[model samples]
Structure formats: C-alpha cells, structure tokens
Target: MNELGSRRLFFKYAVPQMVGLLFNSIYLIMDGVFIGNRLGRIGMAAAAISVPVIEILIAISMALASGAGIMISDRLGRERLGEALRIFKASILLSALVGSAVALLGNHFCHGIAGFLGATPGIHDQAVGYLRYIVLFSPFLLFSFLLGGLARNDGRPGLAMTALTLGSLSNVVLDYLFLFPMDMGIEGAALATAIGPVVSVIVLLPHFLLKRGRLYLEKATIRWKDWLDILRLGSPSFVMEFSIGIITFIYNVAIVKNGYGEIGLAAYLVIGYMMLIFLTLFLGMAEGLQPVFSYLQSVGNHGKNDELLSFARCFFLAIGISCYMGIVLFGRDFISIFSPEEIAMIDLAEKASPVYFAGFFLAGFNILAISFRQSTGRTRSAMAISLLRSVAIPPVLIGLLPLILGRESIWACHSLAEAGTACYIFKTTRRNERWEERWENRLPRYTVEDERTTRSGPSTSRST
Candidate 1:
C-alpha cells in the first residue's frame, strides 16, 4: 500500500466529488421541477430548449477545469510543485476571461442561437427572459467551476462539495421564493438559479484569497503561451460536451422535421437531463479514480493502474445495467415530472433513454482510458480516443443516422457511438499496456551507497 491508497483517501476524495456532482444534479432536477410545475408547458419546453446553449458554456468551463486539473494533478504527483501552481492560477484566469466572453456573446445573440435551435416565434420571449438573467450570472458560474477544480485538486473535495451543495440548495429554495411567491414568472426561476452560482463563488473566493489551502489564488504574469496546453489538453473534454451541443441542435431539427416539433423537443430535453443525472454516476466513478490514477502513474504503479482501468469498466457496466432496468421498469415515473399531459411523451422518453444510454457502460471505458493515458503522460492517446469518440463519430452519427432511421435515430446515435469507440479503445489499450510496462520497469533503482550501510565500520554490508 502506498501513501495514497488508504481507505481514508477514497472516502475523503471520492465521496466529496460525488456529493458535489450529486448536489449539482439534484438542483438541476429541481430547476426542471420548479419550472415545469409553476410556469406551464411552454415554460418547460423553453427551459428544455435552452439546455444546449448552456451546455456549450459548461462545456468550455469543464474543458478547462477538468483538463487543466488532470494535468495539474499529474504535475503535483510528479513533485513539480511550482509548475502545478502556475497551471492552477493560469487556469483560473483563462476560465474567467473565456467565461465572461461566452456570457456576453451568448446574451447579445441569444435570440439568434435560440431560433436556430428551434425556439418558436410564439415562445421567443420566454426564452429571452430566462437566458438574459442566466447570462448575467456568468462570472459566478465560471469562477465556481475554476475554484471547484482547484478544491478537488487540492485534496479538499469537501470544500468543493460544500460550495456546489450550497449553490444548489440556494437555487432550490430561491426557486420557490422568487418564481412561485413573487410572481416573477419564468424569468424568476432563471434568476434564482443564476443567483445560486453567484453565492457559491462568494463562498469559494475566501479560500483563494486567504490562501487557506493547497489551492489558493496567486498573482502572476499571465503566460499567454501556457494557454496552449490548457486548450489542447482541455479540447478533448470540451469537444466531448460541445459536440453534444451540436447533437442537441441537430436532434431538435430532426424532431421538427418529423412533425412532432415542440412535443419532440420537450421529450428530448427531459431525456437529456435524465441522461446527465445518470452520467454523473459515471463521472463520480471517473472522478474517484482521477487522483488515484494521477498518483499511481506518478509512482509508476502498473498493476494498480491496470486494476483501476478494469475497475472503471466494471463499475460503468454495472451502472448501465441499473439505468436500463430503471427505464424499463419505472419509465413513466421518470417522465412523471414533465406533466400528466406527458403520458405519450413519457412512453417515448422511456424507449429513448436506454437506447441512448446503451453504451453508457462503454462510456466508462472511454473515460477510464482517457484518464489513464492523461495521468501517465500519454496525452496523444487520450486525444486520439477523444477525437474518435467526440469529434469524428458524433457528427457523423448526426448526419447519417437520421437519414437512415428517421427521428428516433437521433437519440440512439450517441450510445451507438459510445459502444463503437469503446471497441477501438479496448484494442488500443491492449497496445498501451506494453508501453506502460516498459515505463514501469524504468523507475529509479537504488545505488550501492544505502541506508543499510552501518556507520561504525567499513565492514558493514549493505543490502540492495
């Protein structure tokens, strides 16, 4: 057992990351519940339509945060303490600037993008009211993401968890207070949700300012060139989510062409949120393995590295089974939140999630392989898998599947891609193992001058 392999490590690091993302998902469900119930069907559909746009914002944030964090973790693991600090501080600056830009640009052209994504002329105002408020809160959203990554990498995932939990909790409580009570309408829900992340940032900032922990804010000459690694390393993950944005827009288009329009749009949105919630389970396991992966790779632990890979695969498969079973058994309950008007839609949602999620088991493998390759200083392999899964395959699916299977094929394409990429990943990883072994064997060996040498006499023998 190494310094990091203790049970305490798992409970402290993994649990908090799960708790953070869990609170995030819980509040998302709450947001939907509040809007769907209080606002009306139009509101529900409006919120659903807005998801892809926000996903792009989130995709950018996650790209920098997760990708930079992985690199930061590996740097720390390798004892390059100074470089890790630079990377963290630099990541924050990049995120803040980029996030602010997204907010402004998104708001400026909010209607245009919304229209492109299938916002109706009738409901245009509803989308505008909500997006405007959400955009205003962009700084907080960006800061919260950057700091959350800092907290997790700093070995205080609890701090990050608390930040997100409070943010989510505030959103849930304020949704009732603002939207329901004040008669703020749909905008109120959006405002309340937006304000929640602002509070989270406020709470998180003192940790950075006071330098209370390992991850603290520092002022440095912003290294423009350093953005290269962040963008490069982060692009894969960003593309992973941003490509989803494209799929979402395409799905909306396909559904409309299929003649169901708003109904299909709403159903697709509900199923998408449900998928995110379940994907959190996959992310939880992936995140749990992150620090462990970085640490093991730093120590050059091949056996444990391979074990985590196996563990990740099995874990995701198990979760996929549970998700499929839930959809099969309680499909209506899954869609019950949308409304009693949603019975037909619910049936469709039920049929849609499993097919869309079928390769969720394989998704775990994709993530594990990427994580392993990244942590072990093999970003090229990570990037390749990422390219295969996110860029090349997803768009191709979007273009071809609907043409072949019609509208239902839109939802099914993602999982099919996941399953396909997993096959390529498994084959490539078999090759990667050989490389890992060569590196494993090359770790520093002890010299003749050793601790076993007795100070009393030259005759003291040393054991190698």
Candidate 2:
C-alpha cells in the first residue's frame, strides 16, 4: 500500500473489487432482463416484488461477513493471526446455521411471505414461484456473498473477482437456458440466480484448500462472545441491507397505490436495476478501501487515513457525476436493454431519470463516508448514517412526497433523501474531528499495534 501513489493504490484495489461487484450487480440486471423479455411486464413486477426476500437474505450474510471481515482485518494488522482465524471460522459457521434456518422457513411459507411482502393478487402466484426457488437455495446466495467478502479481506481480491465474474457469467447463460428454451418461467430465473453461488464457491475453494493465502481455518472453540462481536461490529451493515429491503418493499407498495399498479412497478424495476449498477461501483470502492483503513487505524496512521479519505471522496464524486451525465444523455438506451420494445415502461423511467438519479453524485460520497466511519472505529456514526440513508429517510420521503405533492413528485424521493443525508455526513465528519482530538491520546479496546510480515507472510508474532 505504501509503495503506490494514493490513486494507483486506490484503483489497484478498488478496480478489481469494482469489477467483481459489477458482475454481482449484473446478476440482478440479468434476472430482470430475462424475466422482462420472457414473462412480460407482469413477470417483471413479480420479480420486483420478490426483491425484498433477496435483500433480507443478503442482509444477513452481509452483516456476518462485514462485521467479521472488519475484525479479521484488524487482527491481521496487529499480527493476531490466531484470533483472525477464529473469527473467520465462526463467521462461516454462523452463516451456515442462519442460512439453513432461513431456507427451511422461507420455503415452508413461501406463498404466505410473498403476500406479506405486498405482492398484489395479479402477481402473487408468480411472486411465490420465484421466491420459493430463491429461498430454497438461500444457503448458496448467503454463502457466496459471505465468502466473497472473506476472500476479498484475505488478500485475494483477484480470486474474489474471478469467482463472482464466473458466477455471473454462468447466471447469464443459465438464465437463457432455463427461461427461454426450457420455458420454466419465473422459477427458472430464481434457479439461475441460486446456481450462481454454487459457481462462485467452486472458484473460491482453491484459496482455502491450497493454502495460497494468509487466512486459514482450524479447530477453534466458537464462543458466544465471538459471535456477538461479529454481530455488533456488523450492525451498520445489517441496517444498510435491511433498510434497502424495506425501501424496496415500500417503493413497490407505493407504486401500486399510485394507480399505476403493475405498469408503474415495471418502470420502477427498470430504474431500480440501474440504481444497482451505480451502487455497486460506489460500494466496491468503499469495501476496497476497508482493509487499508483498518490497517492504518490499527497502526494509528491517521495522516495516511486522512489522505485516503480525501482521495476516495474526490474520486467517487467524479465517477458519480460522470454516471449521472451518461444516464441523462442516454437513459432511453439504458432502459432499452431490459425491454427494448416496451416503450411505456421505457418512457416512464426515462422521463423520471433526472429526479430519480439526482442524488448519485453526492450519494457516492455519502456511501464512501459510511465505509470510512465503519473502518475507523466510528461505528455509531456509521450506523447513524446508514439508518438515515437506507432505512429512515428514503421511506419517509417516498411516503410523504406523493401524498403532499401528488404522485408525479415521487421520483424525487430518493434524490432528496440522499442529498439530506450527504449534508448530515458532511457536518458530522467535522464534529467527529473534535471528538478524535479529545481521544487521540487514548486508545480504545480494539486498537492494536502494527505487524510486519515475515518471509512466510502474515507472521503470527508482532515485531518487537
């Protein structure tokens, strides 16, 4: 990290991660495209309504992985290899237990849960069909994402990227096979997605088996405290994931209520899929920076941390602005990819593109800030920012705007919510500087000294 300029280091780490996550995001878009083209707008709406289920499952995995990933990176930085290994094992085990339970329970109540998530009568049956396959294969989805996070943190981002890329490519080919030639409909789409994780796991196994890496799993007594530590550190990530699920759920219901019903929802799905693409880039950059921040903070290298933060902020701002311009200029073409001939949905989304996407420029910066806070031991600030952006703010704005200004104003909800939170993050960082100064002389329980690698890499003992 010290060898490269800030820009070079940032891109070196972030680009692979960005590409990996882009592939992951493409999984979502591919599902949308296949479902939209074969199953029609109703199928698209069914898929959209089923998204909350996917999000909730992703939330669980993200919470465990992100929390443990942070702790593991911190331990590795301090040369506490044993502790890092323990946490890693515990995280994987915990994910399995939770994932199995969700799969079992979700399959049993698949239709009921679909109804509970606000699937309208017209789309309810298709929604259940899609959700059932997704839930039954929940273990794969959860583990795939969790393992990807772990792989990234274990100094094998290239492996992580490769795994996700292959998985996504498999999904695209399988989606076509299952959806078109097989005529299996919505369930086929879900199965294609469920199969993606299996591919990722296949690609990821070599890392653990060959021992071509730093992190390893051995027999370690899994403790309740370790699990709690993982959960506690991961709460912000949970909130972020859960908030998106809630927001998606709420948006589905709001679109239906606005009298547009299925057609309106189809349009929203197009916009939502596009949002996923942009979010992956921003999220990829933040997650890529995570290890660097954790290492720097462990060694008390605040100056380097400050520089990274600055570079990331400016970099994402430029990316976000560039993306917004592209969308404004070529939105119809963008929307056309999902449903080239479905002009109604395309026109609706294209017209609302500006308001719908206005927040991305600043939103990119806001997303980076959350990751920054999480990496630097500012969990409370991170959680607050996460809650406001993902859970609290967007829903309120989405609900209130249509009621007050009529339904046409609904497109502005996300932009307004994002802009508001960006302002708060800006102010809070300044306030946090004062708090940091007050506590600079004191070290928290979690802080540890830096470790130097031996010829073997990631030596277990710290340098004296």
Candidate 3:
C-alpha cells in the first residue's frame, strides 16, 4: 500500500470493497422484492418487522470484525506480527462463541422477539418464521464478516470481495429457487440469507489456513483484556450497525402511531432498500480505506493521511450528491420494482421519498468522518458521531417532530437528524484539525525508518 500512489491505493481497496458490499446488499434488496411481489404487503410488513433482528446480528458481527481489524492493521503497521496474529485468533474464537449464543437464545425466544419488534397479530407468525432461520444460522454470518474484515486488513481485499460476491450471488439464486418454485415464502428468504454467509466463510477460510497474508489461524492464549480491547475499539461500529435496527424499530413505531400501519411499512421497506444500497456504498468505501488510515496513523504519515482524507471527502461528496439525485429522479421507478401493482404503496413511497432522503447528501460524509476517526484511534469521537446520527438525534426527531408538526412530518425525521449531525461533525472536525496542526508543529519532524517495514508486506510464517 505504501508503494502505491494515493489514487491507486484508494481504488485498489475501495473498488473491490464497494463491489462486494453492493452485491451483498443486493441479496437483501432482493428479499424485499420477492416478498413484496410474492407475499404482498403483509409479507413485506412481516419482513420489515424481522429486520431489526438481522441488523442486530450484523451489528455484533461487524463490531467484532472491525475492532479486531483495526488492532491487526495497527500491529501489522508496527511490525508486531505476533500480536496481530493473536488478535486474529481471539477474534475467530469470540465470533464463534457469540454467534452460537445468539442463535441458541434467539431461536428459543423468537416469538417474544417478534412481538417486541412491533409485529401485529396478522404478521407475527411470519415474522417469527423469518427470524428463526436467520438466528439458527447466525454462526456462518458472523464468520463471514469476521473473516472478510480480517482478509481486508491482511492485505487481500480482492479475496474478501470475491468471497462476499460469491455469497451474495448464491443467495440470489437460492432466493429465486426457494421463493418461486419451492413456494417456501418468508422462511425461504431468511434461509437463503443465512446460507449465503456459509459460502463466504468457505471462500475466506483458506486464506487464513494457507497463511496467505500477515494474519492466519494460530494457537494463542485468549485473554479477557484482548476481548475487552476489541469490544472497546469496536463499540462505535457496533453502535453504527445496531443503530440501523434501532432506527427501524423507532420508525416502525412512529409510523404505526401515525396510523399508516402495513401500507406505511411496505412503503418504508422499499425506501429502506434504496437507503441500504447507498449506505452500503458509503460503508464499503469507509471500510475499504480503514486499513490504509490505520497504517498511515501507525507510521505517522500525516501528509499522506491528509491526501487520502481529501480524496475521500471529494469522493463521498460526489457519491452523496449523485445518490440523492438518483433518488429524486428515479425513486418512483425504484419503488415500483418491489410491487408495481400496489398503487397505494407506490404513491405513498413516492410522496415520502424527497422528504425522507433530503439530507442523505451529508450522510456519506458523516460515515466517512466516523470511519476516519475510528481508524485513527479517535474511538470516542467515532462513537459519539455514530450515536448522534443513529441513536440520539434520529429517535428524538422521530418522536418529537410528528407531535410538533403533523403526522406527515415523521418522514422528515431522518433528513433532519442527518443534517444536524453533519453540522456537529463539521464543527468538531475543524476543531480537531487545528489541534492536530498545533500538536504536530510542537514535535520534531520524524522520517519513516524504512518503507518496507512501514508497508508491512504479507507474512509467510505459520504459527501454532
């Protein structure tokens, strides 16, 4: 990475990650499509009710993977290969243990969980059916995320992309087969999603098994402190992901309270698919560049760091503008993809589109800001940003705005939260920049000891 030019490095990492994440999100969107077309509004609402559970699972997996990835990247940057390997081993173990616990507990309590997620009596059984399959296969999903992140940090972004792409493609195929010919319905969709990660795990496992990069499977003492460190560093990512579920849950309640009911949920589900694609793009870019940021910070390459940040800012802004425009121009068509026959749902979604997505132009930058902070060891700042955007602001706005304005004002909550958070990020970022500049000036200029060590090329040694 150090040897590559900034543009090349950015593309090298970001493109594959983006492609992989895009494909990964495609299967999720496809679920809505299949449900909307086949099972109708009731099915879509049921699926929506189950979304929080899946998001929570994803959140836990991402937190562990991202936290461990950051630590591994920093260690690799500093040439501490042993420590990196140990963290890698611990991460694998932790993911397995956590995933199993979730699966067991979640399956046992699927009915209660479904009711808690705001499922109506009509959709409650379907929600439980969908949630059950997902929880039953949680381990595979967890491994998919953990190994993919480790692969990226291990300097094999392409491999990680390949694994995810394969998984998503397989899911699409399974979704069609199970939903149409087999007539499996909602459970089929969840089953397809759950099995997709198994394929990804298979593809990624060999990289570590073969010792293809700096990190690989190794026997190491798993300390409680390492677990704590991983969770601490990863808390922001956890919040960021978990907050998706939180937002959905809050929005579902708000929409219900506003008397929109299943129609609202079905419409929101379509909009949520669009949101997922855009969010996946931002997340892919941020995650892809995470190792680069960690590496630069570890090596104290302030100049290069600034250059990458500049490029990322421009890239994120362009993407955000383009996405918002796309939503404005073709949102109706996008909504129609889910259920063209459902004119009421289509009309509702179209009306809600602009207001709901109004401030998404700033969302990518906010995500980038959080990722940059996390990679550079500003975990608190990252957590605060994540919490503000997902947890603090959005919910408050969702609850208060509807009462203050009209019931229709509920659609604007997300946009307002995003816009407000962007302002906060801008202020804090500027302040941090000034402080960093002054701090750098106070220190003597230091040169990198060796480009090779700093680059931290792939490791071939095996550990047991």
TM-scores for every candidate against the unseen true structure:
0.85, 0.88, 0.90
TM-score of 3: 0.90
lDDT by residue (204-270, candidate 1, tens digit) is: 8788788786666566666776688877776666665565566666666767876767667767877
RMSD (Cα, Å) for all candidates, in order, is 4.5, 7.2, 7.6
Q: Would you list the clashing residue pairs of candidate 1? A: none
- Relative to the true structure, candidate 2 reaches a TM of 0.88
How many clashing residue pairs are found in candidate 1?
0
Q: Quick one: how many clashes does candidate 2 have?
A: 0
> CA shift at 19, candidate 2, in angstroms?
1.1
After superposition, the stretches of candidate 2 with alpha carbons farther than 4 Å from their true spots are: 2-4, 119-126, 256-263, 340-344, 402-406, 435-464
lDDT of 1: 0.73
What's the true lDDT of residue 246 in model 3?
75
> Which whole-number lDDT from 0 to 100 does residue 306 have in model 2?
86
Off by over 4 Å in 3: 119-125, 259-261, 403-405, 437-464
Candidate 2 C-alpha lDDT tens digits along 348-395: 999987888988788788778888888778888899999889778888
List model 3 lDDT by residue over 1-464, tens digit each: 67777888788888788989899999888877777778887887788777777787888888998899899989998999989989989998899899899899999999998898789999899989988988899999999988998898988999989999999999999988889999999888888888999999999998889877778877888889889989999888888777767787788788999999989987887788888888889888888888888988888886888798889889888998899899889999998876778899999999998889888878888888888899899999999999999989998898888888989999999989989999999999899789999998997653453344347854443232
Q: How close is candidate 1 to the true structure, as a TM-score?
A: 0.85
